[model samples]
Target: MARTGEFLMALDEGMLAYFREMADEMVARFGIPRAEAVARINRAYAGQEFEPYPDLMCHELPEYWAYGLYFKPNAGRLPDDDPDTDLSAWEVRPAPPAGSPAWTLEA
Candidate 1:
Protein backbone atom coordinates (compact mmCIF):
# COMPACT_ATOMS: atom_id res chain seq x y z
CA MET A 1 0.00 0.00 0.00
CA ALA A 2 1.18 3.47 -0.76
CA ARG A 3 1.98 5.84 2.06
CA THR A 4 -0.60 8.51 2.86
CA GLY A 5 1.39 11.20 1.16
CA GLU A 6 1.91 9.03 -1.89
CA PHE A 7 -1.77 8.13 -2.08
CA LEU A 8 -2.79 11.75 -1.72
CA MET A 9 -0.40 12.83 -4.42
CA ALA A 10 -1.81 10.17 -6.73
CA LEU A 11 -5.36 11.45 -6.43
CA ASP A 12 -6.88 13.16 -9.44
CA GLU A 13 -7.46 16.88 -9.17
CA GLY A 14 -11.12 16.59 -8.31
CA MET A 15 -10.62 14.01 -5.59
CA LEU A 16 -7.69 15.97 -4.21
CA ALA A 17 -9.81 19.08 -3.91
CA TYR A 18 -12.69 17.14 -2.43
CA PHE A 19 -10.52 15.52 0.23
CA ARG A 20 -8.83 18.80 1.01
CA GLU A 21 -12.14 20.48 1.64
CA MET A 22 -13.36 17.50 3.59
CA ALA A 23 -10.31 17.65 5.86
CA ASP A 24 -10.72 21.39 6.35
CA GLU A 25 -14.33 20.93 7.25
CA MET A 26 -13.36 18.28 9.77
CA VAL A 27 -10.92 20.66 11.39
CA ALA A 28 -13.34 23.58 11.52
CA ARG A 29 -16.39 21.73 12.75
CA PHE A 30 -14.75 19.17 15.00
CA GLY A 31 -12.04 21.40 16.48
CA ILE A 32 -9.34 18.99 15.44
CA PRO A 33 -5.84 20.05 14.45
CA ARG A 34 -5.39 20.34 10.69
CA ALA A 35 -2.72 17.65 10.57
CA GLU A 36 -4.96 15.25 12.45
CA ALA A 37 -7.84 16.04 10.14
CA VAL A 38 -5.75 15.36 7.08
CA ALA A 39 -4.42 12.19 8.64
CA ARG A 40 -7.93 10.95 9.29
CA ILE A 41 -8.99 11.65 5.76
CA ASN A 42 -5.83 10.00 4.50
CA ARG A 43 -6.47 6.97 6.66
CA ALA A 44 -9.83 6.48 5.05
CA TYR A 45 -8.70 6.69 1.45
CA ALA A 46 -5.01 5.92 1.46
CA GLY A 47 -5.12 2.20 0.82
CA GLN A 48 -8.40 2.07 -1.06
CA GLU A 49 -8.55 1.00 -4.68
CA PHE A 50 -11.55 3.15 -5.48
CA GLU A 51 -10.90 5.07 -8.66
CA PRO A 52 -12.26 8.44 -9.59
CA TYR A 53 -13.69 9.08 -6.15
CA PRO A 54 -15.23 12.40 -7.12
CA ASP A 55 -17.11 10.85 -10.04
CA LEU A 56 -18.37 8.04 -7.86
CA MET A 57 -19.26 10.16 -4.83
CA CYS A 58 -22.67 11.79 -4.67
CA HIS A 59 -21.14 15.26 -4.38
CA GLU A 60 -22.59 15.62 -0.93
CA LEU A 61 -21.42 18.56 1.09
CA PRO A 62 -17.97 18.20 2.64
CA GLU A 63 -19.60 18.28 6.06
CA TYR A 64 -20.98 14.82 5.33
CA TRP A 65 -17.48 13.40 5.07
CA ALA A 66 -16.33 15.37 8.12
CA TYR A 67 -19.08 13.81 10.16
CA GLY A 68 -18.00 10.35 9.01
CA LEU A 69 -21.31 9.71 7.27
CA TYR A 70 -19.55 8.77 4.07
CA PHE A 71 -17.76 5.93 5.89
CA LYS A 72 -20.96 4.16 6.79
CA PRO A 73 -21.49 0.89 5.02
CA ASN A 74 -25.13 1.68 4.30
CA ALA A 75 -25.26 5.44 4.17
CA GLY A 76 -28.01 5.16 1.57
CA ARG A 77 -27.55 8.81 0.80
CA LEU A 78 -26.40 8.60 -2.77
CA PRO A 79 -28.09 10.61 -5.53
CA ASP A 80 -29.41 7.45 -7.16
CA ASP A 81 -30.67 6.23 -3.78
CA ASP A 82 -32.95 9.25 -3.60
CA PRO A 83 -32.86 11.87 -6.28
CA ASP A 84 -35.10 14.13 -4.21
CA THR A 85 -32.80 14.09 -1.21
CA ASP A 86 -30.89 17.21 -0.28
CA LEU A 87 -28.32 16.32 2.36
CA SER A 88 -27.23 19.90 2.80
CA ALA A 89 -30.69 20.80 4.02
CA TRP A 90 -31.09 17.74 6.16
CA GLU A 91 -31.70 18.15 9.93
CA VAL A 92 -28.62 16.18 10.88
CA ARG A 93 -26.28 18.96 11.84
CA PRO A 94 -23.48 17.89 14.17
CA ALA A 95 -24.24 18.43 17.80
CA PRO A 96 -22.30 21.20 19.44
CA PRO A 97 -20.14 20.48 22.44
CA ALA A 98 -21.78 20.53 25.86
CA GLY A 99 -23.11 23.97 26.81
CA SER A 100 -22.44 25.31 23.36
CA PRO A 101 -25.15 26.67 21.08
CA ALA A 102 -27.24 24.04 19.42
CA TRP A 103 -26.44 25.45 16.04
CA THR A 104 -24.85 28.44 14.44
CA LEU A 105 -26.35 30.17 11.45
CA GLU A 106 -23.84 30.00 8.64
CA ALA A 107 -23.87 33.19 6.73
Candidate 2:
Protein backbone atom coordinates (compact mmCIF):
# COMPACT_ATOMS: atom_id res chain seq x y z
CA MET A 1 0.00 0.00 0.00
CA ALA A 2 1.32 3.41 -0.91
CA ARG A 3 1.69 5.92 1.89
CA THR A 4 -0.48 9.04 1.75
CA GLY A 5 1.20 10.73 4.75
CA GLU A 6 -2.21 11.92 5.92
CA PHE A 7 -2.86 8.34 6.99
CA LEU A 8 -0.30 5.77 5.94
CA MET A 9 -2.78 2.92 5.95
CA ALA A 10 -4.44 0.78 3.33
CA LEU A 11 -8.05 -0.34 3.37
CA ASP A 12 -8.10 -1.51 6.93
CA GLU A 13 -10.88 -3.26 8.87
CA GLY A 14 -12.85 -0.06 9.41
CA MET A 15 -12.76 0.76 5.74
CA LEU A 16 -13.95 -2.75 4.95
CA ALA A 17 -16.82 -2.29 7.38
CA TYR A 18 -17.87 0.90 5.63
CA PHE A 19 -17.74 -0.92 2.30
CA ARG A 20 -19.84 -3.77 3.64
CA GLU A 21 -22.43 -1.41 5.03
CA MET A 22 -22.65 0.43 1.75
CA ALA A 23 -23.02 -2.87 -0.10
CA ASP A 24 -25.78 -4.04 2.19
CA GLU A 25 -27.59 -0.75 1.65
CA MET A 26 -27.26 -1.22 -2.08
CA VAL A 27 -28.85 -4.64 -1.81
CA ALA A 28 -31.78 -3.36 0.22
CA ARG A 29 -32.41 -0.21 -1.77
CA PHE A 30 -31.76 -1.49 -5.28
CA GLY A 31 -33.16 -4.98 -4.71
CA ILE A 32 -30.01 -6.40 -6.27
CA PRO A 33 -28.54 -9.64 -5.05
CA ARG A 34 -25.78 -9.52 -2.47
CA ALA A 35 -23.10 -10.92 -4.77
CA GLU A 36 -23.82 -8.48 -7.59
CA ALA A 37 -23.97 -5.50 -5.25
CA VAL A 38 -20.70 -6.50 -3.67
CA ALA A 39 -19.13 -6.85 -7.09
CA ARG A 40 -20.33 -3.41 -8.11
CA ILE A 41 -18.91 -1.91 -4.97
CA ASN A 42 -15.62 -3.71 -5.52
CA ARG A 43 -15.39 -2.45 -9.06
CA ALA A 44 -15.95 1.09 -7.83
CA TYR A 45 -12.79 1.00 -5.74
CA ALA A 46 -10.71 -1.53 -7.65
CA GLY A 47 -8.25 0.70 -9.49
CA GLN A 48 -8.65 3.84 -7.38
CA GLU A 49 -5.39 5.31 -6.12
CA PHE A 50 -5.20 6.78 -2.68
CA GLU A 51 -5.31 10.53 -2.12
CA PRO A 52 -4.08 12.73 0.71
CA TYR A 53 -7.63 13.65 1.60
CA PRO A 54 -10.68 11.40 1.55
CA ASP A 55 -11.47 9.25 -1.44
CA LEU A 56 -14.91 9.19 -2.99
CA MET A 57 -15.82 5.83 -4.51
CA CYS A 58 -18.69 5.90 -6.95
CA HIS A 59 -20.56 3.22 -8.91
CA GLU A 60 -23.42 3.57 -11.33
CA LEU A 61 -26.20 1.13 -10.57
CA PRO A 62 -28.57 -0.44 -13.06
CA GLU A 63 -30.88 2.50 -12.72
CA TYR A 64 -29.99 6.06 -13.56
CA TRP A 65 -28.91 6.70 -9.99
CA ALA A 66 -25.34 6.36 -8.83
CA TYR A 67 -23.90 5.11 -5.55
CA GLY A 68 -21.12 6.95 -3.77
CA LEU A 69 -19.08 5.70 -0.85
CA TYR A 70 -16.90 8.22 0.96
CA PHE A 71 -13.76 6.95 2.66
CA LYS A 72 -12.34 9.46 5.12
CA PRO A 73 -11.23 9.94 8.67
CA ASN A 74 -14.17 9.82 11.05
CA ALA A 75 -12.71 12.55 13.18
CA GLY A 76 -12.76 14.96 10.28
CA ARG A 77 -16.08 16.55 9.41
CA LEU A 78 -17.83 15.91 6.15
CA PRO A 79 -19.44 18.65 4.13
CA ASP A 80 -22.44 20.39 5.65
CA ASP A 81 -24.84 19.92 2.79
CA ASP A 82 -28.40 19.04 3.67
CA PRO A 83 -28.60 15.27 4.05
CA ASP A 84 -32.16 14.91 2.74
CA THR A 85 -31.45 16.65 -0.55
CA ASP A 86 -27.83 15.61 -0.84
CA LEU A 87 -27.20 12.45 -2.83
CA SER A 88 -23.67 12.32 -1.48
CA ALA A 89 -24.68 11.11 1.94
CA TRP A 90 -22.69 8.33 3.54
CA GLU A 91 -25.33 5.69 2.77
CA VAL A 92 -26.83 4.79 -0.58
CA ARG A 93 -30.55 5.24 -1.13
CA PRO A 94 -33.08 3.72 -3.50
CA ALA A 95 -33.86 5.60 -6.63
CA PRO A 96 -36.40 4.85 -9.33
CA PRO A 97 -35.49 1.45 -10.75
CA ALA A 98 -34.40 1.05 -14.36
CA GLY A 99 -36.97 1.78 -17.07
CA SER A 100 -38.92 4.03 -14.79
CA PRO A 101 -40.70 7.01 -16.28
CA ALA A 102 -38.63 9.31 -14.11
CA TRP A 103 -35.71 8.88 -16.49
CA THR A 104 -37.63 10.49 -19.32
CA LEU A 105 -38.06 13.77 -17.54
CA GLU A 106 -36.49 16.70 -19.37
CA ALA A 107 -33.70 18.21 -17.39
Candidate 3:
Protein backbone atom coordinates (compact mmCIF):
# COMPACT_ATOMS: atom_id res chain seq x y z
CA MET A 1 0.00 0.00 0.00
CA ALA A 2 1.18 3.53 -0.66
CA ARG A 3 2.21 5.72 2.25
CA THR A 4 -0.90 7.91 2.11
CA GLY A 5 -2.91 4.72 2.00
CA GLU A 6 -1.98 4.30 5.62
CA PHE A 7 -4.79 5.36 7.88
CA LEU A 8 -3.86 7.36 10.93
CA MET A 9 -7.06 7.71 12.81
CA ALA A 10 -7.64 11.06 14.45
CA LEU A 11 -9.56 9.35 17.19
CA ASP A 12 -7.55 6.91 19.19
CA GLU A 13 -8.71 3.35 19.63
CA GLY A 14 -10.45 4.24 22.90
CA MET A 15 -12.39 7.12 21.41
CA LEU A 16 -13.11 5.15 18.26
CA ALA A 17 -14.54 2.33 20.34
CA TYR A 18 -16.94 4.77 21.92
CA PHE A 19 -17.85 6.27 18.57
CA ARG A 20 -18.51 2.80 17.17
CA GLU A 21 -20.69 2.02 20.16
CA MET A 22 -22.75 5.15 19.58
CA ALA A 23 -23.02 4.41 15.88
CA ASP A 24 -24.24 0.94 16.72
CA GLU A 25 -26.85 2.44 18.97
CA MET A 26 -27.97 4.66 16.14
CA VAL A 27 -28.25 1.68 13.83
CA ALA A 28 -30.29 -0.23 16.36
CA ARG A 29 -32.62 2.68 16.82
CA PHE A 30 -33.02 3.13 13.09
CA GLY A 31 -33.80 -0.54 12.53
CA ILE A 32 -32.27 -0.32 9.06
CA PRO A 33 -32.59 -3.51 7.07
CA ARG A 34 -29.29 -5.35 6.70
CA ALA A 35 -29.34 -5.61 2.91
CA GLU A 36 -30.85 -2.19 2.28
CA ALA A 37 -28.56 -0.41 4.69
CA VAL A 38 -25.45 -2.02 3.27
CA ALA A 39 -26.61 -1.13 -0.21
CA ARG A 40 -27.20 2.47 0.73
CA ILE A 41 -23.73 2.82 2.21
CA ASN A 42 -22.14 1.16 -0.76
CA ARG A 43 -23.95 3.45 -3.11
CA ALA A 44 -22.51 6.47 -1.38
CA TYR A 45 -18.98 5.09 -1.74
CA ALA A 46 -19.27 4.44 -5.45
CA GLY A 47 -16.48 6.09 -7.46
CA GLN A 48 -15.15 7.92 -4.45
CA GLU A 49 -11.53 8.77 -5.21
CA PHE A 50 -10.32 9.99 -1.82
CA GLU A 51 -11.64 9.80 1.70
CA PRO A 52 -14.62 12.06 1.76
CA TYR A 53 -16.32 12.82 5.02
CA PRO A 54 -20.01 12.33 4.47
CA ASP A 55 -22.58 13.85 6.72
CA LEU A 56 -24.42 11.04 8.44
CA MET A 57 -28.06 10.87 7.57
CA CYS A 58 -30.63 8.60 9.13
CA HIS A 59 -33.29 6.44 7.57
CA GLU A 60 -36.46 6.04 9.57
CA LEU A 61 -37.19 2.43 10.39
CA PRO A 62 -40.00 0.51 12.04
CA GLU A 63 -38.59 0.53 15.56
CA TYR A 64 -35.66 2.95 15.29
CA TRP A 65 -33.34 4.88 12.97
CA ALA A 66 -30.08 3.97 11.22
CA TYR A 67 -27.17 6.31 10.51
CA GLY A 68 -23.74 6.04 8.90
CA LEU A 69 -20.57 8.04 8.29
CA TYR A 70 -19.32 8.00 4.73
CA PHE A 71 -15.64 8.34 3.89
CA LYS A 72 -13.82 7.65 0.65
CA PRO A 73 -10.08 7.41 0.25
CA ASN A 74 -8.40 9.51 -2.39
CA ALA A 75 -7.96 7.93 -5.81
CA GLY A 76 -4.28 7.42 -5.12
CA ARG A 77 -2.07 7.71 -2.07
CA LEU A 78 0.89 10.11 -1.88
CA PRO A 79 4.15 9.02 -3.46
CA ASP A 80 6.89 7.51 -1.31
CA ASP A 81 9.09 10.60 -1.47
CA ASP A 82 6.21 12.97 -0.86
CA PRO A 83 6.82 15.74 1.68
CA ASP A 84 3.99 14.30 3.76
CA THR A 85 6.16 11.28 4.52
CA ASP A 86 5.53 11.88 8.22
CA LEU A 87 1.97 13.01 7.55
CA SER A 88 3.04 16.54 8.41
CA ALA A 89 0.01 17.84 6.57
CA TRP A 90 -2.23 16.34 9.19
CA GLU A 91 -2.14 17.65 12.71
CA VAL A 92 -1.56 14.87 15.21
CA ARG A 93 -2.25 15.16 18.90
CA PRO A 94 -0.63 12.39 20.84
CA ALA A 95 -2.86 10.33 23.03
CA PRO A 96 -1.99 10.26 26.70
CA PRO A 97 -0.39 7.09 27.95
CA ALA A 98 -2.90 4.55 29.26
CA GLY A 99 -1.27 3.68 32.60
CA SER A 100 -0.87 5.11 36.06
CA PRO A 101 1.75 4.81 38.78
CA ALA A 102 1.05 2.61 41.82
CA TRP A 103 2.57 3.05 45.24
CA THR A 104 3.61 0.06 47.35
CA LEU A 105 4.97 -0.25 50.89
CA GLU A 106 8.09 -2.38 51.40
CA ALA A 107 9.85 -3.43 54.57
Candidate 4:
Protein backbone atom coordinates (compact mmCIF):
# COMPACT_ATOMS: atom_id res chain seq x y z
CA MET A 1 0.00 0.00 0.00
CA ALA A 2 1.17 3.55 -0.68
CA ARG A 3 2.07 5.78 2.26
CA THR A 4 -0.57 8.31 3.31
CA GLY A 5 1.19 11.15 1.46
CA GLU A 6 1.46 9.11 -1.75
CA PHE A 7 -2.21 8.16 -1.59
CA LEU A 8 -3.24 11.78 -0.99
CA MET A 9 -1.00 12.94 -3.86
CA ALA A 10 -2.51 10.39 -6.23
CA LEU A 11 -6.04 11.49 -5.32
CA ASP A 12 -5.10 15.18 -5.71
CA GLU A 13 -3.48 14.56 -9.10
CA GLY A 14 -6.53 12.58 -10.32
CA MET A 15 -8.96 15.32 -9.30
CA LEU A 16 -6.78 18.10 -10.74
CA ALA A 17 -6.45 16.20 -14.03
CA TYR A 18 -10.19 15.74 -14.20
CA PHE A 19 -10.71 19.47 -13.70
CA ARG A 20 -8.02 20.32 -16.22
CA GLU A 21 -9.51 18.02 -18.88
CA MET A 22 -13.01 19.38 -18.31
CA ALA A 23 -11.75 22.97 -18.49
CA ASP A 24 -9.87 22.25 -21.72
CA GLU A 25 -12.88 20.55 -23.29
CA MET A 26 -15.18 23.39 -22.33
CA VAL A 27 -12.75 25.98 -23.74
CA ALA A 28 -12.39 24.13 -27.07
CA ARG A 29 -16.16 23.63 -27.44
CA PHE A 30 -17.33 27.07 -26.20
CA GLY A 31 -14.41 29.39 -27.10
CA ILE A 32 -13.96 30.23 -23.43
CA PRO A 33 -10.73 31.77 -22.13
CA ARG A 34 -8.38 30.00 -19.70
CA ALA A 35 -9.44 32.09 -16.67
CA GLU A 36 -13.16 31.65 -17.39
CA ALA A 37 -12.66 27.95 -18.11
CA VAL A 38 -10.85 27.50 -14.83
CA ALA A 39 -13.59 29.49 -13.09
CA ARG A 40 -16.20 27.19 -14.61
CA ILE A 41 -14.24 24.16 -13.47
CA ASN A 42 -14.07 25.65 -9.95
CA ARG A 43 -17.74 26.62 -9.93
CA ALA A 44 -18.64 23.03 -10.83
CA TYR A 45 -16.56 21.95 -7.83
CA ALA A 46 -18.47 24.27 -5.46
CA GLY A 47 -20.88 22.09 -3.46
CA GLN A 48 -21.43 20.10 -0.25
CA GLU A 49 -18.30 20.71 1.88
CA PHE A 50 -16.68 23.03 -0.65
CA GLU A 51 -19.51 25.58 -0.71
CA PRO A 52 -19.52 28.32 1.91
CA TYR A 53 -22.09 27.66 4.65
CA PRO A 54 -25.06 29.85 3.72
CA ASP A 55 -27.24 29.72 6.83
CA LEU A 56 -26.19 26.94 9.20
CA MET A 57 -28.15 27.78 12.32
CA CYS A 58 -28.28 24.67 14.50
CA HIS A 59 -32.07 24.90 14.98
CA GLU A 60 -32.70 24.88 11.21
CA LEU A 61 -32.45 21.08 11.01
CA PRO A 62 -34.94 18.48 12.31
CA GLU A 63 -35.18 17.99 16.08
CA TYR A 64 -33.40 14.65 16.01
CA TRP A 65 -30.58 15.84 13.74
CA ALA A 66 -30.07 18.93 15.90
CA TYR A 67 -30.14 17.18 19.28
CA GLY A 68 -28.58 13.84 18.31
CA LEU A 69 -25.20 15.39 17.51
CA TYR A 70 -24.89 17.37 20.76
CA PHE A 71 -26.41 14.83 23.12
CA LYS A 72 -26.42 11.03 23.44
CA PRO A 73 -29.60 8.86 23.27
CA ASN A 74 -30.60 8.74 26.92
CA ALA A 75 -28.34 10.48 29.41
CA GLY A 76 -28.21 7.35 31.60
CA ARG A 77 -28.04 4.74 28.84
CA LEU A 78 -25.19 2.40 29.72
CA PRO A 79 -23.38 0.45 27.00
CA ASP A 80 -22.97 -2.61 29.28
CA ASP A 81 -25.20 -5.61 28.52
CA ASP A 82 -26.35 -6.30 32.09
CA PRO A 83 -29.84 -7.21 30.91
CA ASP A 84 -31.29 -4.03 32.29
CA THR A 85 -32.68 -0.90 30.57
CA ASP A 86 -32.65 1.20 33.74
CA LEU A 87 -31.02 4.44 34.84
CA SER A 88 -29.56 2.52 37.79
CA ALA A 89 -27.16 1.03 35.29
CA TRP A 90 -25.65 4.55 35.08
CA GLU A 91 -25.94 5.46 38.78
CA VAL A 92 -23.24 7.95 39.65
CA ARG A 93 -21.85 6.02 42.59
CA PRO A 94 -19.21 8.59 43.59
CA ALA A 95 -19.39 12.29 44.25
CA PRO A 96 -16.87 14.76 42.81
CA PRO A 97 -13.70 15.17 44.91
CA ALA A 98 -11.28 18.11 45.15
CA GLY A 99 -12.10 19.74 41.78
CA SER A 100 -15.69 19.68 40.53
CA PRO A 101 -18.21 19.82 37.71
CA ALA A 102 -16.44 22.37 35.48
CA TRP A 103 -19.60 23.36 33.61
CA THR A 104 -23.04 21.90 32.93
CA LEU A 105 -25.49 23.18 30.33
CA GLU A 106 -28.26 21.67 28.24
CA ALA A 107 -29.74 23.62 25.37
Top TM-score prediction, candidate number? 1
The C-alpha TM-scores of every prediction are 0.52, 0.40, 0.25, 0.33
After superposing candidate 3, which stretches have Cα over 4 Å from the reference? 1-26, 51-107
Q: Which runs of model 2 end up more than 4 angstroms from their true locations?
A: 1-10, 49-107
lDDT of 1 by residue, 6-101 (tens): 234356666767767877776665476565566555555555554565556636777766766323323554322244655454433323343322
What lDDT would each prediction earn against the true structure? 0.52, 0.42, 0.29, 0.32
- Look at candidate 1 and tell me the lDDT of residue 42: 53
User: Candidate 3's residue-wise lDDT over 1-107, tens digit each?
Assistant: 11121122233344333333443543454353333333332233323332222223212221122222211223433213233454334332221122311101110
* Model 4 ranges with Cα > 4 A deviation: 1-11, 47-107
Clashes of each: 0, 0, 14, 0
lDDT of 4 by residue, 1-107 (tens): 11122111122343444434554654554354544444433332333221122223222322222122222455643233223534343432221122322111110
C-alpha root-mean-square deviation, candidate 4: 22.6
* Tens digits of per-residue lDDT for model 2, 1-107: 44221222345444444455665765665466665555554444454554332334323222222134322223454323233545344443343345533222221
Identify the superior model by lDDT, candidate 2 or candidate 4: 2
User: Which window of 10 residues has the lowest lDDT sum in candidate 3?
Assistant: 98-107
Candidate 1 global lDDT:
0.52
